[model samples]
Target: MTEKNVLIKSWADPITGACPVAEILRTLGGKHGPRILHCLTEGELHFLELTRAIDGISRKVLTDQLKEFEEQGLILRSPKNDARQRVGYSLTAKGDALCGVFGQLYDWSQYYR
Candidate 1:
C-alpha cells in the first residue's frame, strides 16, 4: 500500500466512525437543502411560499427536501390548522446554528465574489 493511503486510513478510521461533519454535509450539501434552510431562517413559511421563494424548485423536490430536513431535526413541520392540514416549516435550534455557519460562509465568500 502507498504511504499516503496508510496514513489516511490510520487518521480516518477512528474519526470517521462518528463524524457529524459528514452527516451535516450530507444533509445540507444538496441543491435545495441550503436554500431551504436559508429561507426558513427568515421565518416560518408555508409550502407554497417556500416553493415560490426558491425559484426553479419543483413541488416534488421541495417536499422531499422538507421531509429529509424534518427527519434530520434541522427543521420543524407543524400543521397550521387541525382541519385544513396546512403545514408550516421552521428552523430548529440545530438548524439555526447550522445556518449561522452558512451565514459566516456567505460572508467569507463575499470577499472572492
Candidate 2:
C-alpha cells in the first residue's frame, strides 16, 4: 500500500488491533467539544471567555464539559496569577494533536458539502 493508503486504512481498521476511532468519536461527540477545543487552541482562556466564545452554551454545561476534558487529560486547568485568582484552560499535547484530526475532518467536510 502507498503511504496515504496505509494511513487511511489504519484509521479505518487497524492491522492488528482495534481501531480507536470509536473512542475518539465518543470523546468528540457533543455540541461544544469542537468549539471548546477550538477556543483553547488560540491559547489559555478563563471560564468566562470560553462561555462568551461558545455561543448559546450555559454555565452548567460549560463547567461539565471542562471538567470532563480535564479528567480526560485533554485540557489543563490551573490557577492564573491574577488578582481575581482566575482559572485558565489550555490544551495539552494530546489535545493539540487531536485538534489536527479535527482540522482534517473539517477539510473533508468541505469536500462533502
Candidate 3:
C-alpha cells in the first residue's frame, strides 16, 4: 500500500475506533489542551504556574484539563514537595513527541495565512 492509503486506512479501525492521529487531534483539539501542552514543553510547572502561564484559563478548566492529560499519559503530575504545596507537571516522552506536530501545524497555519 502507498503512504497515502496507509494514512487513510489508519483513520479508523474497529478496535481502536480512531487512529493515532485522530486520537491526538481529539485530545488536543480543546481550547486549552494545546496551550497547556505547549507550556509544559518548556519544563515542569505547578498548577498555579500553568494557570499564570496560560492567561484567561479558569482554575476549573485548568484542573479538568490537567486531569485528562494525566489520564491519557501525556503529562505527569509530581507530588507536593514545597511549602506552598505546588504540584509539578511535565510532558512524558509521548507528549513531547507531539510538540513537533503542533509546531508543524503552526507552520502550516502561517504558510496559509
Query: Each candidate: RMSD to true structure?
Result: 4.1, 4.1, 3.0
- Candidate 3: tens digits of C-alpha lDDT, residues 16-100: 6757767778877779999999999999998888999998999999999999899999999998877887789999997898788
- lDDT (Cα atoms) of all candidates against the true structure: 0.89, 0.89, 0.88
**What local lDDT does model 1 show for residue 45?**
95
Which residue runs does candidate 3 get wrong by more than 4 Å? 1-9
lDDT of 1 by residue, 42-109 (tens): 89999989999999999999999999999999999988875868899999999999899999999999
Q: In candidate 2, which residue pairs get closer than 3 Å at backbone N, Cα or C atoms, i.e. clash?
A: none
State how far residue 15 of model 3 sits from its true place (Å): 3.8
| Cα-based TM-score, every candidate | 0.80, 0.80, 0.83
| Model 3 alpha-carbon miss at residue 91, Å | 0.6
Q: Which ten residues in a row have the lowest lDDT in candidate 2?
A: 7-16
